[model samples]
Target: MIYYFSGTGNSLHVARQFADRLCEQLSPIVNPVLTHDKSIGLVFPVYSWGIPSVVDNFIRRFFQSAEVRSETPPAYVYALMTCGDDVGYADRVLDNALLSASGRKFDAVFSVQMPNTYVCLPGFDVDSDELCKAKLNRVQARVSEIAELVAARRKDVRRLKRGIFPFAKTYVVRPLFNRFLVTDKYFHVDASKCVSCGRCRKSCPVGNILLIPTTGGQGAEVKEVPKWMSHCSGCLACYHSCPHHAINFGNMTAAKGQYSIMKQLHG
Candidate 1:
């Protein structure tokens, strides 16, 4: 069985590819399900040079559940992490999380470069059309190779792309990012530009957005705008999926480009 957590479709697309190649069933990490499969695979996006909180929490819960702890044969655990550029010791971080929760680390870990979607800070934005195309073009072959290795039950595989200064990025910057930038409070929607569409709410994988109807023009126009809740996956899906680009993360995303993997693939 393969468990996955995707925000804007990158991880989901990659998970689907692996599931097709390996003939495994895919389940969202947020959903609760019990399985005794010998091979357990996890696919998720790397966030803030580490695992997203939602994914982390799910991993803990999934392993500690009464149904999962009593399994007989050990599972061949592995992980596939998708990142914009690099993962920076994220595999180690995930291994540690799994070790702490279930007393066993991932036997194999892989990282794949996906299109850039993080744009909440200065000097960081979505990739250009050429770069996005280049990344997408390579994902299939990479995922295929990974699936072949995984199908062979390859152990001790650590194929990953950890860019320079990995320790600093994972240990130092990740903590700060989790503390400061992972909240939904910074999300802003331009009421004037909003078309009263529910796409923002739909874009959120965790259902952390709400649309409230209010009188806009002389109490005649009831416009529905997005309001964020406390629980956020920090995926920036709301910012990327808005048709009119009305959503912004604080003020940093005002000029950033919006890249959607589904739109890039299908449209």
Candidate 2:
């Protein structure tokens, strides 16, 4: 089985491609319950030079569950991360996290460079259409190579060489990001532009978005507005998937472009 956690369809696209090539079932990591015995593949995007908090929690829970411990571990475990650039020591971090959680490690690790979707901060912006298309083409070729390796059950560890800066970034900055940066307090929806579409609520993997009727008096027709809860994963699904571009993370994302690999390729 291939389990994936995606915010803007980059990892999901990779997961689907892998599933097709391997003839495996594709499962979302949302509230996953692992009961059957089979080789496992995890696909997700890198966040803040580390795994997304949602994926981290899911991995920890899945490995520590009694259902997984009651039987032999998966015959082979592999991980594929999608990133705008390099995954700085994320492969080691994942291996270590798995080993610490369940005394098991990924047999193989890989990464694919996709269009950058993390534009909620300064110094970051979505790639231009031409560049994004080029990157997608490259990702397709890389995924094909990854599928070949996975089919052969290759046990190679593909990680970027780490130095002092990379180590500090991954170990120090990553923890800070998980602790302080993953929240929905800064998200806002423009009332004028919002169409009361529940796409944001549905796109949130953590159910952090709530659609509540706008408060008013005197024959004011009911209209829903999205309110973000505190338990956001900072995956940017609601921001990127908003059909009307009504959602914004503070002032950073208002003018930024939104990207979804599936939409870019198919629509």
Candidate 3:
């Protein structure tokens, strides 16, 4: 089985491609409750040079559970991370997390470069059409190579080159990102642009967004607005999936454009 966590369809696109090539089933990491024993593969996007908090929590909980502890580890295990540039020591972090939880390590780990989706931050923006297409083509070729190796059950461990900067970025910067940067408090919908469409709430993987009716004057027609809960994963799904570009993360995301792999592929 291939378990995946995707915010704006990058990782999900990769996971589906892998699943098709390997003849495997695809499972979402959201609220994962595994009971069967089979070869396992994980596909997720890199967040802050590390795994997403939701993926980390899910791995910890799933592996440490009584159900998993009662059985032997899978025969083969692999992980593939999608990132805009590179995943600095993310593989190491994921291996350590798995070892800490289930006392097992991934047999293979790899990365694929995808268009950057973390647009709320300054100096980051969605790729242009030419760049995005180039990236998609390159990643598709890379995924094919990876799928062949995985189908053969071969071991391929790709790690970041040993360096102080990469180490500090992954170990020190990642923790700070998870602790301070991952929150839903700043997310709000533009009332004028919003169409009462539930796309934001539907796209959120963790169900952190709610459509609440506005308290207008008496006999006024009510419209629902998105209210973000406290349990956001900072995945940017609600922001990128909005049809009218209605969702905003403070002032930063309003000017930045939206992107989704599915939309790009279909369009």
Candidate 4:
């Protein structure tokens, strides 16, 4: 089985390609969630140099549960992750999770670079179409190499040691990061350009942003909206999916470009 978690489509796209290569069942960890203890593979994006909190919690619970024991344990497993930068100990996070659960080890691990769309965070930049295409090609090559290694039973794996930063970020830096940095970058509704159509609010997956009545309440509402940041996945789905293009990622992101992987696998 292949287990995947994705806020945007980057990791999902990779997982889908991996499933196609292996001819295995693909299961999502979120959005119609499922549980699996059988021989498995994990695919996701590296968030803050480690697994996302939701994914970590899922593994912690999966191993601690009694139902997982009756199934065939994973004799061979692999981990694949995509990141905007070098993956620092992200594979170790997954390795440790599996190790704690059943002493199972990863047969192979891989990381690839995808376009960074999480404009909600500081220093995050949107990739141009040209850059995205080039990186996607590189990632596809690496992924294909990983698939070959999996088929060959090459057990060249590394231990995850960069736990200090991940732990500190997950426990300490994350709270402040969410509280301070998560606003005004994910999606911004342009009041002057917006027609109060509620297109952006409806398009938001997390519903953190909504349309509210203006002070005068003339047509509908212009700018009064909730600023909840905890629920955001930084996918930019709201920004791209909006019909009016009124939703943006602020001025710095106004000129920023975007890209996506349409083909399941690249040749």
Candidate 5:
């Protein structure tokens, strides 16, 4: 069984392809089903140089709530983490979480580079069309290789991209990033540009968006606009999926680019 968490469709796309190659069932990390399957896999994006809060919470709940099948847990547990660049010890963080929850660490872990979609901060933006295409092209082979390794049930295997200052990036900066930046309070919509299309609400994976009604003027027609609840997974799907580029994370995203898996495949 493979469980996944995705936003902007990158991890989901990878998870679907990985599952197909291995002939394994795929499920969301949220609302995870209890499984007696021998091999359990996790596919998700590495956010803020670590696992996203949503993924972390899912690990806590899903592993802690389930009863162990035996003295040892699943025979082989693996993880495939997608990222814009490097994962910076995110695999270690995940292993730590799994160890705490189930007293077992990942047997195999891998990270693959994907198109950049983390554009909510300065010095971070979406990749160029050429780079995006390159990353997407490279990912297929990497995922296939990972799937093959997982199928073989490789143990003690760790293939990660831990960039400069890995310790500082994961331990110090990640906590700060998740604490401050991984939030929905910074999100808002440009009502004029929104057009009340409900695209943002539909794209949100966590159902954190609501379409609220508002009037244009006195006695004017009321239209529903996107409003964000505070339960965001920090995936930026709403921002990247908007056709009109109407969504913004505070004022930081106005000049940033948007990219999604569907856009790469079809756009």
Candidate 6:
């Protein structure tokens, strides 16, 4: 089984592609507690130098709730992550989470580059169209190459920007972003552009939104209001799929680039 936690479409897209190619069953991370099917592989994006709370909780509850079965094969754990910049810190976060889960063991871990979406920094710029296209092409090629290795069950170490930098990312960079940037002003919803549509709520892999009934100009009305679950995976599907462009990442995230909801390329 392939379990994926994605915020936008990048990780989900990659997870779907890998599962399709491998002929494996794909499961969304929203249902954290599922019956144990040892044929498991995990794919997600790194956020805040840690596994998104969504993925962390899923692993915790899923493994704990699972019932061992004869048909259930031994879990051969594989992890794939997509990142905006250096990847070392995220790997450490993942390693710690897996260790916390007790029984799960990682056979391999891989990383891939997606556009750096953390635009909350003081001076951030989205890639130019030409540069973006070039990077996309590179990602495509890298994903394909990594897929072949997964299909063949190769065991190789894969990382980016060495190890030390990524280690500092979560501790230094990510913490600052989370404290003053992400939580403060990054995730926002634009009411003016919204048409009272609840599409974002439905598309959310984690069911984070809560639709509420309110009296509007037309009288009694029901609207999808975002009441974010703290366990957000940072997929950004809510931001992208907003038909009215109602979702905003606030001041801190206004200039941040869009993140790919795809998975990583394992070595």
| Best candidate (score: TM-score) | 1
Candidate 2 has its poorest 10 consecutive residues by lDDT at 156-165
lDDT of 4 by residue, 1-267 (tens): 787876557888788877787777888765524556345677877776666655666676665566664566434667787777656666767677867875665677788688766564456666766677777777666767777776665686642324346556555665575466555444556666656656456645456575675543566544553343556655466665454556666565565444335532251
List, residue by residue over 187-223, the lDDT tens digit for candidate 6. 6665445666787788777676665544445654545
- Per residue, candidate 1 scores C-alpha lDDT tens digits across 104-218 of 8888999999998899888898998888889999999999999989998899999999999999999999999999999999898888899988999998989999999866578
TM-score of 2: 0.91
TM-score of each: 0.97, 0.91, 0.91, 0.70, 0.96, 0.76
Error of 6 at 245 (Å): 3.3
Question: Model 4, clash count?
Answer: 1
In model 1, the clashing pairs are: none
Candidate 1 — worst ten consecutive residues by lDDT sum?
213-222
Query: Model 5: per-residue lDDT, tens digit, 146-178?
Result: 888888888999988888988899999999998
Q: Candidate 6: where is the Cα deviation over 4 Å?
A: 32-39, 64-73, 124-126, 159-164, 175-188, 213-234, 254-267
- Candidate 5 TM-score, true structure as reference: 0.96
Q: CA lDDT, every prediction? A: 0.90, 0.83, 0.84, 0.63, 0.87, 0.63
Error of 1 at 161 (Å): 0.4
- lDDT: which is higher, 1 or 6? 1
Instruction: Kindly report which residue stretches of model 3 are placed more than 4 angstroms away from their true locations once superposed.
Output: 33-35, 70-74, 159-164, 215-221
**Model 5 stretches astray by more than 4 angstroms:** 69-73
Number of the predicted model whose lDDT against the real structure is largest: 1
As for candidate 4, its clashing pairs are: 39-74
**Which is superior by TM-score, 4 or 5?**
5
Give the local distance difference test score of model 5.
0.87
Over 195-218, each residue of candidate 3 has an lDDT whose tens digit, in order, gives 898999999988998899884577
Which pairs of residues have clashing backbones in candidate 2? none
